[model samples]
Target: MLPRRFNLHRPDRIEDAVALLAEHGDDASPYAGGTELLIAMKARVLSYAHIVDLKGIAALRGVSARSDGGLIIGALTTHHELANHSLVLERLPAYALLSANVANIRVRAAGTLGGNLCFAEPHADPPAMLCALNAELVLAGPGGERRMLLAEFILGELSTARATGEVLVRIEVPGLPAGTRAGYRAFGHLERPAVGVAAVALPLGKGFDWRLRVGSICGRPTALAGLEKAMRGLPEADALAVLAEGAEQAAAAVEADDDIRGSAEYKRHLVGVLARRAARAALGMEALAA
Candidate 1:
């Protein structure tokens, strides 16, 4: 099926794009990589009379290092670019690996990070890791720019906190402390993950600061707060035991729904398995063969 007829407007500036969105109101959408939007439009699941193309806005592209030893990634950047970019590979190789495996090569080539988040598909991968890394989103609007934690930006499945005319400009990942390591694990069928987990381990003397996030099995990414609290101050070996033992209980606390992907029980099981694997990977342990 063909997308309903629409007028495409290319705006070179962020303000201009916001203006177009504001002017059209609900009739328009800010277009980046059209991967998700185009699919919905083509299926007639969504219809927009005006499409505000943001690709012409040069400010929304590229990967650069931050003075704080973190990263600033343009929202409009493609997954393929991120996977191969030097700074991304050097600073957050786990993220780079995740980007490299998103869907297929074609989607990675054309899909933009901003689009993926704005679309807010529950089965997507980036949100989990971004949340674990404590990433923040910078949004541009007629009122000027406002920033929020990425975890707060996503309201639920297929929904977000973006206002009427706000445009997501960039994603900010804070620097990890020395000796910090991060890892991500996801399992699924079709092209999307059924359950994805991201783990970050920051050394705190002999103990560790553990951040864990589980995604795709629920409406939005869920932090394993219970497990994190239990493992936070434990020695390396003890922490691993806590994580391995508590993973299933922690996963069961999150509400998983039955879907075409799998039964809620199965997804919860996957969550536990992946969470333990991700935490181990973050601790520089070897991956166990399937």
Candidate 2:
């Protein structure tokens, strides 16, 4: 149950919400769908005397296509909305499918993508995919709005680069390049992921280009830059072998911790296994329909 004496302020305007946050400082926290924040509060892990309810802000909802061919999702857009959106399914089926499978139906009903990303939970799904797609985040603050890479927005477990007085207003996913394919692989039990890998392959002239990221092993998602560099220009069979080997090496590159999820070494092995699978999926060898 929520604390009996805490104050609630409903702000329909972004500027007003930021002003309240500026006034209350650490005492104030923004409230979205509250799927994550409220649970933490009820567990006594976090306490805020002032809750700045942002659900009243009409501007922070919906999806639209940008002229650049990117997709803009509002901060208030729920997991359910995005998962089933026609345009999302049409343009970025990989992302649409990922959104569809986030947690359970109940959590998807109450959780907002903005909340998920803003919370920066390490074990969640969107971060790795966002990183591979080179997504951008739009933040609104006292100075107006600014854009940041989704990769930079998430700093660590339950941490983000968002300032106290700023709010993430939208997520921008760039248009997929011609002949580019994307895939994501994750393994978990009890609704918590142990390892998640994302792969994107682009056909460039006479060769293939790859982008890979390994997540849920450490505090932050890690890109496999070395592996991508090595895979460049390799033939089909050669690329598969290199991806497998690189997956093992990718494990070493991440600073995974030994926690209840699994041992560090065990998690590293999962990264390799999933990386190969994800690579195949990205290459359209083993594809899933949204």
Report the number of the highest-TM-score candidate. 1
Taking every candidate in turn, the Cα RMSD to the unseen true structure, in Å, is 1.4, 1.6
The prediction achieving the highest lDDT against the true structure is 1
lDDT of 1 by residue, 1-290 (tens): 99999999999999999999999999999899899999999999999999999999999999999888899999999999999999999899889988988999999999999999999999999999999999999999989999999999998999999998889999999998888888899999867999999998888868899999998887789999999999997898899999889998998898899999999999999999998899888777845221
lDDT of 2 by residue, 158-244 (tens): 889999878889998888778777888888775868888888877865557888888888777898888888888777678888887
* lDDT, model 2, position 281: 81
- Report, for every candidate in turn, its global Cα lDDT versus the true structure: 0.91, 0.85
> Per the 3 Å backbone cut-off, how many clashing residue pairs does candidate 2 have?
0
TM-score of each: 0.98, 0.95
Clashing pairs in model 2, backbone N/Cα/C closer than 3 A: none
